[model samples]
Target chain A: MHGLRRVPENLSGRGDKVMEDKYDVVVVGAGPAGSTAAYSAAKNGARVLMVDRRRELGVPVQCGEAIAEDILNELGIKPDRRWAVNRTNAVKIVSPSGIEIRISEKKVTGKVGYVLNRKVFDKFLAVRAVKAGAEAMIGSYVNGLVFKNGRIGGIRGVGLDGKFEVAADVVIAADGVGSRVARWAGLNTALRFDDIETCAQFQMVGVDFESLSMLEFYLGSRISPGGYAWVFPKGDDLANVGLGVLGSRAERRPIEYLRDFVSRMPGLSKGKIVEVNVGGVPVCGPIEETVGDSLMVVGDAARQVNPLTGGGIDSAMRAGTIAGEVAAKAVEEGDTSKERLKEYERRWKEAMGKRLTRYLKAKEILLGLSDGELDKLAEVLRGVKFDRISLTDMLKVLVKANPKLLWKLRGLL
Target chain B: MEVDSSLCLRCGACVSICPVDAIEATDSYVRPNERCTDCGACRKICPVGAIK
Candidate 1:
């Protein structure tokens, strides 16, 4: 009676005791995307509710925890010392032939990055949403959607309280890869095995020499098939060593590749393993649809990720912010129709569309290259200075340096 | 790629990966349309191994 609001306890119509299950906006999945959307929506005066099935927020980190500095700035997330584990400036791209090419962070845009303590960074985002008047509940499993007049109306699931359905003016699905929520809502959110990178990472301590000042990448089909291996130092001799393999090309598990990868790296081989993380990252181009009726899907659910690099945190945040703003405005206009939610798709496309399209084209070409071709690619990129090292930029450089080797890829350009 | 239909969670991973937009998913089944080139990209990502 103290903290509970009364409504229908159940549709069975027993006694009058019930809980209020209504909000202006409901966001499923309390990761970066969900929290950002909740924050944006609440900031714009939409009473928001965020839910996640995780018993604790940000635990069991699933990513490499690397974020470009500009991505953080794009989302207006300030550089906070607390969540940032390492301020990385140097980066090296190693070829199949053991050729190492150092790329300056300032020269290659987005190369200037940080290795985050995601356990803290993710929670910080959810806290920001709560501070903005958005309420969040963990341990809530949203099993299905509530449809009204063929439009998304709310969510139904078992939570700490029990099985219940909550109503909302809009439902924002920010669930990550393998999003059943998106599927249940009649949306296509699947990644072809070829378009997905099954990644595994290990946090290892006692890493040998060299400053935690650089992020490194190793490329070769032998090492990771269609994906690559990385070493992201978290400072204090603790580093995340990981490898991702194209799901289709993976003969064994991605973890096997990571284990083999770790043993090869002198800095990682002997280090003591502390934490291991495994997950599926979608690398497909943007989905054909992102919104329908009163529903707006943001982040990975919409495939708002870089097709070339398996990174989505920044894109997720950006999409979430836009979804929140658009949802709030739609609510104020009393239009939660499909047409109204289309504005969210429009804004995010304007912001991140071109880059993603270019990346997708580039990814197709990269997948077609062999390890020997990759070595040649490394050779051509040695002396090049990258003001902004994007897939488009890389493709241009490759075509220019090795005209014959990559002439077939010119059509994409 | 063959659509088992039974194992298909209808997640659409295959439908989205069709290079030629060959696959479509209904509430019950996922199948390749006339446009299918049989590139097999969709079968690779099916979580349930519904497609082969």
Candidate 2:
């Protein structure tokens, strides 16, 4: 009531078709998280149904298209050659003063990481879910949640065929950032403007670059201010050129920032914009909670995005795997109540909460840095002991390893 | 969708999802552009209760 709104919740659908009546679990989205959740649940023997609003899955790609190689391996997903467009060996960070430093290869998950073909990767995940025995449908949009006795009873929505209503013992709200499912299930998914980072990107063709395999990062208040501009090369002649601006620090629209950034870069300036994509990122880290009666939230709906990198594909898949497993367990136990379902929240936190907490703090500190400070940071990091960001390392261990390489990071410790 | 200046968290959900791309989000606030067409896409998709 203070800063939120809701639809009446009654106008979902008519229960006419038997196929739309129910399932053991219903996943709300078909993106990586949702699809992964459905796959995991179905694999564990849960009767699962996953629906997407898009007719063609993974079209209109809405991502930065980068994932850590280590995470992919950790998740037991074999890298698909067809879905990997480019492989970058290192990350090249350019400071405000034009000082370029390569973040150590050892620090990253792999010596080479792939730039994904999201169109293929997203579809790949959804198809996997279907193959795992989950019923997958596209062109179906979830309109509202059917609540009974203060619990999530079912879902009501529409599709190309007609109106549909499906009851389910468990619901997985794997919908993305603007998820209506979470709200309908009584979760307050409101993010503050300041907590959101405005983002815009262009898939540019005809670009000239020194390193076709280097993942390039440009930093400065003028360049991206509170966020970083990236040139993730798909090839020597093409790249995904984009920037995300911290909502509070952006003086102009995100598009304007990217336009100015593109104009100033020699290679990028000469490139033609093939496609433009814009989005918002909740940088405040994961929401306070992720579970409710007969329901669980995953992926962007739960704000599982990395506060620093704006990367959630790995984390989403990780959470989806956990949520699906837990949901299936609840169904097997014949208890879909919040008490029984609380394990999903517990398991997700155990798997992802710690890292997200660290990134949230890191994002705040990173935002306060000036160009000179960032340059100094670059200088300090040049002496790092390892190649990775050490996201899980204790603050003292990071500083102790390279005493003079960084600035006064005592606060971070 | 109308941003409730006092309530709007400026999360950019409405701005990002506007089908016709009408909303513009700056650091301070979010507003509709000339092309808004009052399609109400933003109102339906805003995560915060800000849009009405």
Candidate 3:
């Protein structure tokens, strides 16, 4: 039991553990957020280390595999040849009545995003981090934090063969939704039932499509209450179709809703499911704050995913970059305490936090709307034709029934 | 089968996000089982991914 401080398994006498490794920073988890954070910090002259409990990084890939192109540019990371399944120029919004509208008009600047190959994509990001001089330790399970003076010191974890301890000046909690790192560091992240989106997804192989270059989003209460269903083409006649319902209203299993949705839809139901994947996305605004002494949180851990659209790859990458930079800056100033690290919270909020707050409020208002109201809103928008309907203007009309929403609608419009 | 008590801040993020509700908090740890679909939602939504 070397290096294992607090043995979690009820195994007898597991506390007598010890391995010695050290770094300027240690990041747990090897998903997009973690890899990016590790890469950024290591590139900035920090002795960084990253770990993942899984034997492999990208196996059993669990994401919708949708990512924005612009985000890739900001990170100076290019999508490798093996990571792209298909490219799309537009995203079609389909109403409950089956009305369809294409939101992109041009070629380069159109609604552009990628349907990725997660196996390759996940590995690609981590490899970049390694290339930047960060050490990657796979199959290492981080069991707890090592603390000193009530400040975060490092992580205590185990591998397939042995246990180890890695001390660091800071820890970036890019560990994802069930992140224990943030809580252990003394930050609060409890979520309400209504704030979560329980999701179910299926990878279908035999689906024939009218169009393969565009992603389709279906909006209707009969299908997904307080959420929407999506069809993202993954090529080779395959597509990833899924839906998310508010956790509080999720009475039945997510698969049941997904099955009903695909079977009823004309184009989607024709295919057979080759793979089934289920997950959840935190569609709320950021936590009250995501920084504490000697620690910071990023990606889903920070609750930066868009509540309305449930898209997070772009935002998570953005958050990872911020966390990495702030952690490095904190080290430079020799202030690992939470008070000086508040800049991360402030900078993140100023950059993307404001929009997330608005999006969360908008989602609450949108979820409360009735099916008839949605149909009416869709109809009104159809009546008011334009090359592209301004989303803010359209939302204003949709939220007219709620005065509180109206009051909050000033700067948004 | 093992949960870091220090990591489990009792945020209930796992309880709320688990598709099958397999995660339940005892006085000390959050427990799950074969009933869990391994959707990884709890893992993903976990502010710390502490479920591992």
TM-score of chain B of each: 0.87, 0.84, 0.72
Worst lDDT run of 10 residues, candidate 1 chain A, spans A2-11
Report the C-alpha lDDT of model 3 over A1-413, residue by residue, as the tens digit: 11122222212222223223777778887788888888887777676777776656765555678876779877777666589778876667778777766655365445457899887887788877777767777667777799877767899866655778888998988877656677667676655667777677889978866577777888887788778888999996799998887766765655678899999877788888987665567787778778888788888877778888888778887877777777877787788788887887888888788788778877876787777766666765554433332467566654664455465455555
lDDT by residue (tens digit), candidate 2, A1-413: 20011111101211133143678899998888999999899888888878776666776576778877776777798898888888777777788988876654663344667899888999889778877777765667677798878779888877656778888999999877767677767777765556677777899999876687688888999988789999998876989998888766777766788889999999989899998766677677998778888889999888999998898888899999999999998999999888888888888899888889878878787787789977876665555554553544434554666686246454455
True contact recovery of candidate 2: 0.14
Off by over 4 Å in 1: A1-19, A107-111, A385-393, A411-413, B1-52
Instruction: List model 1 lDDT by residue over B1-52, tens digit each.
Output: 6888666555444544555556654333467768788887766655445676
- Decoy 1 TM-score against native: 0.84
* TM-score (C-alpha, index-matched) for candidate 3: 0.83
Per-candidate local distance difference test = 0.77, 0.76, 0.71
Candidate 1 docking class = incorrect
Q: Model 2: how many Å of interface RMSD?
A: 9.7
**Candidate achieving higher lDDT, 1 or 2:** 1
* After superposition, candidate 3 runs with Cα above 4 Å error: A1-20, A383-390, A393-411, B1-52
State every prediction's TM-score relative to the real structure. 0.84, 0.83, 0.83
Q: Which structure among the candidates has the greatest lDDT?
A: 1
Residue A68 alpha-carbon offset, candidate 2, angstroms: 0.5
Better candidate number, 2 or 3, judged by DockQ: 2
